[model samples]
Target: MKAVQVSGYGGLEKLELVETPVPKPEKGEVLVKVKACAINNTEIWMREGAYGTGSNSGWRPEGIKFPRIPGSDITGEIVQCGSEEDRLLIGKDVVLFPFTSSGERGNEHIAEDMSFIGSEYDGGYAEYVVWPADLCFDMPLKTYSDSAAFSVSGLTAWHMARQVDIQPGETVMVTGANGGVGSLNIQIASKVFGAKVIAITGDLKNEEQLKALGAAEVLSYKSTRLQEEILECNGGPVDTVLDVVGDALLAVSLKVLKKGGKFCTSGSAGGQITQLDLRILYLKHITMYGSVLGTRAEFKELLQEVSNGKIQPVIDKFFPLEKAREAQDYFKQHGKTGKVILLPKTGDDLQI
Candidate 1:
């Protein structure tokens, strides 16, 4: 088997494409022949050795090992399963949940001992992977690209919307609105969750595209008095703010949030640390939430919406598995409108 491994995080050179042994399924596990996987901001963090530290790495609940095959958003087919009872799953197209926890079924994301696919263990940067059979869900109506696109970004956005409890007719603000999670967050908030969406980005080149995705308005940080502009456009302060940019906009977000409004954050692509005036929390009665990936229930709900055609995962570009290093570089260097996908060199053509 050929896979891309992060030999020891640092630069693009760390991601080396090498030959490795194919892993077989253990009891209650399933082997998936990789079809497609998506590049995520998390992967960049992994490549930089951002997580798994003593004091700073809260994202990786489990310690990481070297030479890790790093890819979490996956969609593939079950080629083999440990138990014959589950053998019917072979040849079934599915998406893996990307967690190593058992949390009373639905609330797995918040489990105390939770771990992830790409970071905690070997992931889908290869032609094959082995995951718990129970964590795999059948992909009913999506292509391999669609499934991979929706894997992490969709699940994370769904959880953020739920955390903020976005409502119909209420204004919801989404930061980093052109990135994978941010773009999907905009769609779920307005199209599925029914909130009036406000998108914030550094550049408004994607304004028309965003408005078509249900964003009522798009604001750029380059504008003077960003907080004031947001307030003026929405008629007043917004009811909720979904931030993926983290520190870069956290302060501005607080200024635009209405009294008692909820702020839900799922990523810190800009930088994790930010300045916060403690007075705002008590004075405005604002509620803030820091979320990561979502639970199984949330993932299923997201999938249901996709299956029903209520939401669509956007793909910015595709790269062959061997070009993963270039994919990661592009993901970090460019501001794309959607998720970036990587296809296995298994002879399948790119499917729309």
Candidate 2:
């Protein structure tokens, strides 16, 4: 089988399309014929070698398995399993949870023996990958490959919303609302979760896109007086702020929150290191929480939501597996309102 591999992390150029053996499932594992893989910011940073430094380098709980295939967000069908206990997923369609050995991104702390797919382990950039049978779910809907690819991103957003135990009718602000997770958050918050949704983004091109997904209002970051605009939307304090862009925007998010509102962050697309004064935490008594991806159970729960049509995963485009390198570059250079999917078996007459 052909897959994307990199001898060392550096840039898009480091990723190469190469031939590799199709892996067989081990004990308690199921082999999945990966039909689709989605690109996230985590892949972007890792490809650029940003996570190859400092504490991050130490957090390779899954260890530095070199010639790595970096794709974590994947969806596909199972073809083989080790045993009946491991056979729950044979022929079932599903998406994987982003929770891996280093807690998805090898962020602060990851044990030396554990890691996630696409990060420390070979991922779904190829025609086939073997998932631990326990990690796979049954994709039970009519949506295409891209929509089912929301398992990780959707679950992360769901977990973030649940952190504060959000209440219906409460005002919620979502940053990066045009991105995959951001777009799903808007849909879940407004339609399923029952919160009033306000999106913060500068993608004026996607304002209409966001509205169709159920955003009550869309605010551009480039516009002057965004804080003032947010104030008008909720008339005062917002109940929750879900941030995708951290660092510079974090301080403003604190100001936007109501006296006791909570702030939940799932991404640091701007930069992981947040440089803000801790004094604000004392003054406002604000609750700040960070979601590292989601637990196994949460991924299953998110899949159920998609199956029931409560949430939808927006797809941007699909690329063939031979050009996984080009696909990663396209994710960075081309604009996206949702996820970019890579099909491993496209037009190759390959099947599980």
Candidate 3:
């Protein structure tokens, strides 16, 4: 099997494409012939040794094992399975959640004893990946692999935008407006929920693209006047602010919210620790929440949205399994706007 692996925690250069042994499913597991795998900021953070701190890892679990194959979001065909019921999924195309939990430790989900495909175990950055049946979901439709590959980012966006309990006619602002999650969020909020969407793009180049996705307004944050521009465009009050790019943007985004508005964030490419003032929250009566990959049920609802064509994945590019490093580099350099995909050695005509 040809796969991507890293010698240790470092940069993109650490990724190695090599012929590793193909893995077979265990008693309760299944093997997937990966059609497409997608990258997330979580992989980047985990790879740079930025995940899991002092007994608390953000997504990588408490004792994250490394020298890892880094990719989580996946879309593929089932080649084999452990049980009769599980094997029923074989030959079927599917999309997966990648994260699994067998139990709960109070309010948060404690990862069960199972592996988190690309993070803890060898993921789909290879010709084949092995995992249990509990982690997989049959893809509902025929679509581009990159589109199906957006499971993680798309579902995360749905969870974030839906958190405000967006009511039609309400207004919401989305940062990283053309980004994987942000783009889907824009369409989901506007097209499905009928919310007025205000989107923030780092580049002025994406303004029209944002608007086409139903953003009521698109502001490029470069002019140093984005914070005010957003408030002005809404003409008065904005209901929710979704921040995908953290750092300065978080605090700035909060400032643009209407009284009693909600703030939601999922990624922090702008640097992990951003400052936020607590007093302002009290004065304006604001609500804030951190978002991550959705729960199983939430992902189901999102998939329904996908099936209904209420939202669609925006893929910036795809890569062959061997070009994993280039894919990672392209994403880090902002050379790609949406999800980057990795396909297996199965010799499919599918291009990233």
Highest TM-score model number: 1
lDDT of 3 by residue, 129-182 (tens): 787777678685685374464577887887786677999999989888877788
Output the better candidate (1/3) by lDDT.
1
Q: What does candidate 2 score on TM? A: 0.89
CA shift at 91, candidate 1, in angstroms? 0.6
lDDT of 1 by residue, 1-352 (tens): 8899987758999999998878888899998989999999887787785765543443555456777898999899888898888888989999988788767776788888788888877899999999999989988465898878887888899998888788889999999898889989989999997989989877788889889888999999778889888999999999999998888889989988889999998888877888899899889999999888888888889999989888877888999999998899888864578888999875343211
Q: Which candidate is the best by lDDT?
A: 1
**Candidate 1, backbone clash total:** 0
**Model 1: lDDT of residue 316:** 88
| lDDT (C-alpha, whole model) for all candidates | 0.86, 0.75, 0.76
Candidate 3 RMSD to the real structure: 3.2
lDDT of 2 by residue, 324-344 (tens): 777777776524788888877
